[model samples]
Target chain A: MSDVFGVGVIGAGPVTQAIHLPTLARMPDRFRVTAIMDVDEPVAESVAGRVGARHSTSADDLIGDPGVDVVAVCSPHRFHAEQVEAACYAGKAAVLCEKPLALTVADAERVAQVSRETGVPVIVGAMHTFDPGWLGAKANWGDLQETVRVVNSSIVLPWNARYEDWATQILRRPPPGEPVADDALSRSVAVRDAVLGLAVHNLPHVRHFLPDVESVDWAESVDPYGYLVTIRGGGIIARLLGNMHGYWKPSWTLDAWAADQSLHVEFPPSYVQAGSSVATLTSDTQTRRFGGVEANGYEAEWLRVWELAAGIVPQGEDLQATVDDLIYAVRIADAAADLVRGEHARDRVR
Target chain B: MTEFADRPHLVTLPSGPAHRDIAAALASLPRSFRPGAGEDAIVYVTGDDDWPASVEHALSVARRAIVVIQPGYAQPSTVLRLAERAATDSVPVMIDYAFASNPAVVLAAAAWSAAVEPTGILDVTSRHAGDGTGPMAVLLDQLAALHSLVGPVRTIRQLHIDGDAHSAVVAIPVGGGVITATLLGARTELGSRGSRVRWLGPTEALELEVPHAGTAGPGYSRHVTTEGEQLAPTIYENAHRATLARLSRHLEAGAGRCDDLTTLAGHLELVPREHPSRSASQRTSDQRAN
Candidate 1:
C-alpha cells in the first residue's frame, strides 16, 4: 500500500456528507477519497463528484475496486457486520465502521472472528473513546477502576442541527427514515436501535472508569425521549442518560468519583472541532484542569484508523476490545428494553 | 403585619441549616420576627424525648414556632411529630427544610411558577464532600425546593444513581400544568455550597447558582429570555430568611395543613438508600397512609 491510501466509502449519507469528508479533507497527505457507494445513486454521485471520486450504486463494486486500498463502512445498522466482513476478506489494507460493531453480541462476535481470521485490522468508531481528554483521564487515572464509587455520564442534546450545522452546510440532505410504529416487531427493533445508536457511545465510555459491569440494576426509556440506565456491580456503579429530544442546549459530561479524588470530563458535540474535551482532576489537596490536547475525538478516530492502516500500533492490539465495548452497549440497551417491557406488564396489571 | 404583635415572641430550634437564615429573613421585614420567647425551647432531643409534647408546650406559651431539620441527620418521625402537633394546636409552625431559603432556589421556584405557561423542568443539585451515604441533606433541600417550585410531586422516577451521586426525576401535575424536577447530587465540590436550581421555561431559561448556602453574599443568577439576558435581583440574601418570610405570610393567612409528614415520607419514600432501595420503597408504601 502507498503512503497515501485511496479510500472507498460504502455509505454516502450524513456521516459521509458531514463528518468523514470534512475530516479527510483536512488530512490531505495520508488519505484520499477514491470512490463513494450508496443505494441512492444521486447521493453517491453528488458526494463523489465533490471529492473527485468515482460513484457506484453497488457497494460491492466500490469494495472490489483496485484503486481502493481502505474500505470505510458508514451504512445503516443492518449492513455493518456483512460490509466490514467483506472488506476484511477482500484483502483491504484497513476496514473502518461506525459504532455498534453490529446490533447484537453474536453479530459483534462474528465481526471480530472474521477480523481475526482475515488479519485485516478493523476499526470500530465510537469517537468519544478515542477522545484526547478521555484518553488523558485513562492515562492519569490511577486505580480509579478499583477505587471508583460511581461513574455518571449525562448528555443533554437539543437537536443534531445545532452541532451538525457547524460541521457541514448541507443544503440538501438525505430523506428521513420512517418512524417506528407502535407495534411488537417495531418496538423490539426500536429498543435495540435506541441502544445501538445512543447508549453505545456512553456505556463503553463509562467502562473506562468501571470496566466490569456485574449487572444492570435498572433501565428505562424516559417519557417521550431519552434512556436512563444504571449498572451496578463489583463495588462500582454507573449511570448513563441520553436525551434525544431535550429542549435545552446540549450538555455532555462524564464524571468519575473516588473516595477523595474524581475526574470530570466535558465533551463538545460530535463532528465539530470546537475544542478538545476538558478533564478536571480534584483531590483533597489540589484541583487541576487539563486542556492541553489539540485534536478532537473525531479527528483522533481517523488518525487511529491511519495508525492501524500504517501498522504502527503496538502489539496486542486486540480488536476484540472494540467488539466487547459494542456488546456492552447492546447488553445495556437490552436491559433498558426489558425494563420498558416490565413497566408495560405492570401497567397492564394495574 | 401585627399578626403576632401582642405575643411578639418566636421560638426556634438549633440555628443551623436554614434556621439562622430564616431568622434573618424574618428580621428584615417589619413586625415579622421576635428575638426572644422568654424560654429556652429549642430542645436538643436527639431522638430521646417526646419532641411533639415539647413542641406543643413551646407553642402553647409562644406566639409562633420554627423547627429546623437536617433530614439525613435528624429523625424524620421526630420532626414530623413536632410539626403535626404545632399544626394541630392551631399554632403557626415554620418547619424550614435544609437551606430551602437559598436565594437561588427561591428565584428559580418563583420564575417557574410565574411563567405564562408555567410549565417547565427544575434541575436542583447539591455539591457535597462526604462519605458514601452522600449529600442526603442537600437532597432533602432539593426535594423541598422542588415541591415549592411545582407542588407536591405526583410521579417520580429514579433515573440514575451511584455511590456518590443520586439522580431522580419527579413530576408535579398541579392545576393545569406539569412541572418536572431533576435532582442530582454531586460528591466532588468541597465548598458547603455549589447548589443550583435551574428552570427551563417556555419563554426563557433561568439558572440560579448558590456558591455557599446562607452566606451574606448574593448567589449568582442568570435569566435568558427571548429578548435577552436578565439577572434576577436578590430579595433576601439567605433562603432561610425567605422560608421564614413565607411562614409568616402563611401564619398571617391562617393556612392549616402542615406538609411536614407528607414531605418527609415522600423523600424517604422516593429516594433510594445506599444498600436497600426496595426496602425503603416498601417502607414508603407501608407508611404512606400514616
Candidate 2:
C-alpha cells in the first residue's frame, strides 16, 4: 500500500462532487483521488479534471485500475450493493459505500458476505457514526446505553439544492420528476424511501440505545415530504421525525434521556462542509460538550477507510457492525412502511 | 375602564404543585395591586389540589377575578360547571400555563400563526424531573401552551404513556387546514428542564423555548423566514407574574369575558383520562387488526 491511499469514486453526482471531493481535498496527505466514474461521460470528465484524476464511464474500469486501492461506491441506491461486491472481489483493501449499502436485505447480506469472504473492509457512509461529537458522547456517556428510556431523532431541512449549490459547482444535475401520487401504495413507498434515504442517516444511532425494535407503535406520512414514526424496543421508546421543505434554517438533532443523564447531538445539515456535530452529555451534576473541531464526519470516515486499508485497524468486528447497522435501518423502514400501508387500507375501508 | 376606589387585593391559596412559586409572584406584584384581604380580591389557585372546591370558594368570595395556575387533569363536566358559575357571577377567570403565559410566547403568537403552514408537523417536547408533577400534568401544561400558540386542539390521540414518558398526537385547526402536533414528554433529572415547541413550514420556521415555571428566566423564541431570522424580545418574567399582570389588566378593564375554563374543558376533552384498559402493545395490535 502506498503512503497515501488512492481512492476511486463510482458516482460524480452532487454528493461526490460536493461532499467527497471537497473532503478528500482537505486530507491530501492521507488520500488521493485516482479515478472518477459516472454514467455521463461529460460529468465524469468534468469532475475528474478538477482533481487531475482519470475519468471513465464504467465502474469496472475504475475498480480494476491498479492505481485505485480504495473504492467509494457513491452511485445511486440500487447500484450500491453490486458495486461494493465488485470492489471487494477485485481485491481492494477497503470500500466506502455511500449509505444504505443496499436497498433490500438480501443485497445488504450479499455485500456483507462478499466483504467477509474477500477479507476486504467495507465502511458504509453513514457519516454521523464517524462524527467526532457522536463518538465523544459514546465514550463519555456512562451506563446511558442501558438506562436510556426515551430517544428522539428530528431532522428539518431545506431542499438539498439549497446547500449543494453553496458547496460546489455541479457538472450534471438530475431533472425533477413528477409529483408523487396521492394513494396508499405511493404514500407508503414515499415513507419507506424517506426512512431509508433520510432517516437512515441516524437510525444507527437510535438503534444503538434501542437495539431491538419490538413494534412500530404508530406511523404517519406528513404532507409535502415528511414522516413521523414511533417504535418501541429494548424497554425504550424512540420517535423519529423528518421533514424537508423550503425552510431557511436546517435543524438536525438527536436527544436521549435516562433517569439522571441525557445526550443531545446537533448535526450540521448535509452537503455543507460544516465541522463536526456538537454533542452534549448531561448528568445530574455536570454537563460536558464535545466538538468544535474543524473535521466533519466525511473527513473522519475517509480517515477510517485509510486506517482500515493500511491495516491500522481490524476489519472483523467493524464489518459485522456495518452489516448490523444496515439490518437495523432496513427493519425500521420495513415496519414503518407496513404501518403506513395498513393505516391507508383502514382509511379506505372507512 | 372602571376606576376602583383602591387597588384590588391579591389572595393566593397555599396548595397545588406550584404554590410556592405562585406565592412569590403575588408578593412581587406591582404597587397597583396589593396582597391582602378584601371583597374584591383577586383569587389565585393551582389545580392540583381540590381545585373545584377552591375555585368555588373563590367565586363566592372574590368580586374581581380568578386565576388558575397549571390546571392538571380535570373532568370536562367539572370544568364546564365552573365556567358556568364564573359566567353567572360575572367574575373573569384566567388560566396560567407555565410556558404559554411567558411574555415571549405572547409576542411570538402572531408571527407563529401567520407564517406557519399547516402541511407539516409541529413538534413539542417537554422535559421534567420525575420528582415534580407526574406526566399527566406535564402533558396538560404542554396542551395549554399549544392552545395559546395555535388555538384550539381539534383532536388528540395518546400514543404511549409509561412511568417516565408520555407521547400523544394532536391536531390543531388552523385557518383552512389542520396542523398535526406530536407531543413528547420525558422525565429526566439532567439538562435544562423546559418545554419546546417547534414548527418548520415551507418558507418559515418557529421555535419557542420556555424554562421551568419556577424560575424567572426569560423564554426564548426564534422565527426564521426566507427574508431572514428574528428573535422575540426577551422578558425576565415567569408565568405566574405574567398571569397576575393579565388578571390585573382584566380587573382594571372590568367587563371582559373569561374563557380559561372553557378552553381547559376543551383541552381535557381532547385527552380523556379513561383510555382503554389495555397495554400499549395490545392497543397497537388492536389498531393494526382493525
Candidate 3:
C-alpha cells in the first residue's frame, strides 16, 4: 500500500475538521489529505494549513488537482449532488458526499444517475453504518429478540451551522443567486432538511440491522425547538428524535431489543465527541468501543469508501442500500412537510 | 375564571372542578427553592393545544427555565420559539411528551433538538408500545429501552398491576424505605397510559391497611402477579427480594445514583392540601366563634 491514498476534501467546516481530515491523518498509509476547496480563500487556506492539504478557491480547482485521487464533498446539503456529479464526471475513482445525499429526491436521483453513467464508485456518507460497534451490534442481533418490538434512535446535534460559512459566504459573494426557497417562519423547514440529513445517517443502520421493514408509517412532530418522528415498521415501533434546546445530549444513541436482551450506545454529542472521535457500544452481554482519531467519524467512513473504491467490497443494490434509506428519508421528510403545512393531521398521518 | 388575587406564585389556573384541590395545593407550595432540589421543574400540560404565551411568562417569572408538556399537539413554530427563548436566556428548555403514545411527537422533538445544541435536548420515553399490550410485554419493552439509554438504576422491589382493573403499585428500590411507585392507569375508563408511579419510601412488605369503598381490614394484600398469576404474599416477597438482588449489580457498578432521578422523582410528591382563606367577616366570625 502507498504511504497515503491522496485524498481531496471539498469543505472547510466542522465535519471536515472532525471527520474527514483526522481520519485521513490517522491512516498515513491508507489515506492522505492532499487538497481542500472552499469559497472563502482564507478559511480554505486555514484548513489546508492544519490538514496539510493544498487550498483551492473552487470545486473545479480541487477536482483537477493532480495529487487528488479521491474527492470528499463536505459542503451543505444542496451542494452534494452537484459536487458528487462533478467528481464522478472528472473520472475520480470514488465520490463520497455527506448525508441526505441531496436536498431533493430529483437531485439525488440525478447524482446517482450521473455516477452510473460515469462508472465511478459513489458512496454516500453514512458513517454510522461503518462503525465497528454497529458491526458488533449485528453480531449480537439474536440477543435482541425478546425486547425487539421497537427501535429508538436519538441523534441530538449541537448548534452546528446549517451550512459551512464558506458555502453561504460564497452564495452571497459574486453572481448573487435567487433566494433559496425555505420555510418562512423561524426557518423551521430549512432546519427540517438538516433533520433529514441527520436521519439519513442513522436510518440505514436501523434498516440494515433490524428485521426487514415491511411498511413505514411516519409522522413529523413540528416543534421549532426540535423534531420528533414515530416510525412503525416491521412490527417495530421506533422513534427518531433531534433537538437543539434543553440540555446537551449525546449525538448518536441506539436502543433496541431481543426478548430479554438489550443494547445501549451513548456517545459524546456531535463535534465534541467527533473531536475525541470514539464510538462506544454496550449490550446486556458485553460492551465494545472503537474510534479515536482526530478524524472524527468520517475517517472510518472514508476507509469503508476506500474499500469500495478499491473493489474490495462488492457493489450493487446492497451497496445502494444507503440510497434506499435516503429515499425512505425523503418519504419521511415529505410527510413532515405535509404535517407542517397542515395538509394532514399530525397524528392521523402516522 | 377565579381571581388569583390571593395566589401570587400560582403558575397554572385550576382548570375544572376535578383539578381544584390539586390547584389549591399547588397555590400553597413554598416558593423558596429547596436545598438539593434542582432549580428546574417540568410544568406539564395535560391536554393538547397551542401553548399560550402566558405559559411562557409564568415560567419566566417562577423559575429560570421551563418545559411544556405538549405531547400530540406540538407546533413547529411554537417549539422553535420556546427553544430560541431558552437559548437566548442561557436557560435550558425541554418539551415533554409523557402522555404521547404516538411516535410523531418523539420524532419531532428529536428533530427540533438536533437542529440546536445537542445538550439542549433530552428525551424521556417508555420502552414499550402501550396499545392495551399485556403487562409483561409492556414491562419487558420498557426495561429494554430504559437499559439501552441509561442503564437500569433501580431494582424492582414490588410489581403490581391489578387484575381488578382498579389501581396497582410497584416498588422501586431506593436507598431508604421501599419506594412503592403505584400506577393509576387501570382506573381510567379509556385505559389511557397515564400511570402515576409513586415511590413509597422504605418498608418490608409493609402493607398499609386502607378502608376500601365498603370493605375493611387489608383492602387488598397488595397483590403481586407473575406471568399474570397472583402469587402468595410469602412467595411474592421472595420474588421481590430476588428482583432487588439483580439491582445490586447496578449498585455495585455505581449506576442508580444519577442525580436527576431523585430531583425528577421529588416533583411527584403529593403537595399538601391547602386550607381555604377566610374573608374579613368570616375571619371575625370564626375568631368570635372560637
Candidate 4:
C-alpha cells in the first residue's frame, strides 16, 4: 500500500456527500478518493468530479478499479452485505460498510465468515462507537460495565433532511415514502426500521453495558417515527427512546448509572461536522468531562480505517465482535417488533 | 367570591421532613398574612406522612382554607373522600405537588398549548437520589407534574419497576388526539435530582426543568416555535415557596374552589395495579433467589 490509499465509495447519497467526503477531504495525506459509484449515474459522476476521481454506475467497476485500495460500501441496506463481500474478495486493504452490515443475522454471519476467510478487515459505520468522547468515558469509567444498574438512551431530533440540506448540496435525493398505516404490522415494521436506522448508532454503546440481553420488558412505537423500548440484560435495565419530529432543538443523549457512578454522553447530530460527542462521568465525590475534540466520529472512524488499512495499528474490532454487534441490533429490533405484534393481537382478541 | 373581611392568618400542621421547608416558605410570606393559632387561620398541612389522616384532621380543624403539600402518593378513595369534605365545607384546598408547583411549569404548559397542536409525545425523565424516596414516590411526583402541565393521564400502557428505577408509558388526552408520555424515573446518587419534561411538536417544542423540592434553584422553561426559541424568565423561588405564593393569591381573590384533589385522585386511579400477580417485594425476593 502506498502512503495514500486510493478509495472507492459504493453510494453517493447525502451521507457520502455530506459526511464521508467531507471527512476524507480533511485527511488528504492518508487517503484519497479514486472511484465513486452510484446506481444514479449523475450523482456518481457529479460527486466523483468534485474529487477528480473516476465515476461508474456499477459497484463492481468501482471495486475492481486498479487505483482503488480501500472500498466504502455506502449503498442501501440490502446491498451492504454483498458489496462488502465483493470488496473483501477484490483484495482491498479494508472495507467500511455503512451500518447493519446486513439486515438478517444469516447475512451477517456470511459477511463475517467471508471477512475472516479473506483477511480483509471491515468496520461498520456506527459512528458513535468510534467517537473519541465515548472512548474516553469507556477508558475512565471504572467497573461501570459490571455494576451499572440502569441505562437510558434518548434521541430527539428533527428530520434528517433538515441537517442533510444544511450539510451539503446534493445532486439527487430520494423522495419521501407514503404514510405508514396505523395497524400493528405497519407499526412493527416502522419501529424495526427506526431501531436499525437511527438507534443502531447507539445500540453498540448500550450493548457495552448490557452485554447479555435477557428480555425486553416493553416496546412501543411512537408516532411520526420513534420507539420506546425497555430491555433487561447483564443484570441491568435499559430504556431506548427515539423520536424524529419537526422540533428545532435536537437532543441526543445516553445516560447510565451504577450505585456509585454515572456516565452521560451527548452526541452531535449526524451530517454536519460538529466536532465530537461530550461525555461526563460522575462519581460520588468527583465529576470528569471529556470532549471538545476537533474531529467528530466520522473523521475519527475514517482515521481508524486508514490506520487499519495501513497496518499502523492492530485491528481494534475483530470480525466476531462486528457480527455480534449486528446480531444484537437485529435481535432488539425483532424483539420490539414481536412485542408490538403480540400486544396488538391480544388487543384484538379482547 | 368575597374577600375575607379580616386578614387570613396562617397556621401549619406538623408532618415529616418537608415541615421545615414548608415553614421556611411560610416565613417569607407577604404582610397580607400573619402567623396565628386556632381554626380561623388558613391551615397549611404538609402531607409527608399519613397524608390521608393528616388531611382529614386539617379539614376538621381549619375554618378558612387548607393547603396540603403532597408527599408523592395518594390513594384514590382517600382523595375522593377528602375532596368531598372540602367541597361541602366550602373551604378552598390546594394540593401542592413539588414539581407541579414550580412557577415554570405553568409557563411551559401555556406556551406548549398555544404554540403547537396537542398531538405529539411528551418525554419526561425524573432523576433522584436513592436515599430520598422509593421508586413509586418518584414516579408519582413525575405523574403529578405531568397532570399539572397537561391533563389527567388516560391510561398506563405499561409500567416497569426494577429496583429503584421506574419507567412507564402513559397516554394523556389533548384536543382531538392523545399525547403519549414516557415517564422515566432514575434513582442514582451520583447525578443531580430533578425532573425534565419535553414536548416535541411539528413546529414547536417545549422543555421544562424543575429542581427537587426545598431547593431555591430556579426552574428553567424553554419554548421553541418557527420564529425562534424563547426562554421564560427564571424564578428564584422553589416550588414550595411558589405554591405558598399561589395560595396567597387565591386567598386574596376569595377563590373557594380547587381541583387539585380531584386531579390527584384521577392520576392515582390510572396508575396500574402493581404488576398484577407479583408484588415488588416478591419480585426482589425472586431475583435474590435466582
Which is the leading candidate under TM-score? 2
Query: Which DockQ values do the candidates obtain, in the order shown?
Result: 0.23, 0.58, 0.03, 0.46
Give the Cα error of residue B283 in candidate 1, in Å: 11
For lDDT, the strongest prediction is 2
- On residues A1-350, what C-alpha lDDT tens digit does candidate 4 reach at each position? 68799999999988898999999999999999999999989988899999999899999888889899999999999999999999999988999998879999999999988887888888888889888899999999989888888898988888888888777764255543555677889988988998888888889899999988899877767767788888986568788988887657788999997778889999999998999999999998999999868889988888888888998876655567878988999999999999988876775785
Question: Which stretches of model 4 miss by more than 4 angstroms?
Answer: A171-176, A345-350, B1-8, B13-16, B30-49, B61-66, B90-93, B115-118, B130-133, B255-257, B274-290
Model 2 agreement with the true structure over A24-100: per-residue lDDT tens digits: 99989989999999999998999999999999999999999999999999999889999999999999989999997
Better of 1 and 2 by TM-score: 2
lDDT against the true structure, per candidate, is 0.65, 0.82, 0.46, 0.80
Q: Write down the RMSD of candidate 4 (Cα, Å).
A: 4.1
Docking quality band of candidate 4, CAPRI definitions = acceptable
The residue-level lDDT of candidate 2 at A268 comes to 96
Residue range with the least summed lDDT across 10 consecutive positions in model 4 chain B? B276-285
Task: Write one digit per residue (lDDT tens) for candidate 1, span B1-290.
Answer: 34553333353434324345445655676465565445423221111123344445556665444454444523445556656676676555544443465656666666655652434345566666543234555566677776765567666655454555666666666558655566766565443445767665534666677655445567666776646667877653655555556666676666765565457656655554443444553465457447
For model 4, fnat equals 0.44
True contacts kept of 2: 0.66
Candidate 3 residue lDDT tens string, A1-350: 34346788898877787656656666777777889888889989988988777898899989987788788998887788888888888988787887767777777777778877887888877766665555555664554544455466666543344222332233332332232243333233633564585665667756644444443333333232345555545445555665442222234677554333455554444433343324444444555555444444455677777876676775465336666777777776666555444423331353
* Model 4 lDDT per residue over B61-177, tens place: 887788876544556766888888888887878877667777778666665555535555788887776443466666677787877777777887888777888778887877776
By DockQ rank, best first, the candidates go: 2, 4, 1, 3
Total clashes in model 3, counting residue pairs 3 or more apart in sequence or in different chains: 58
TM match of model 1 to true structure? 0.82
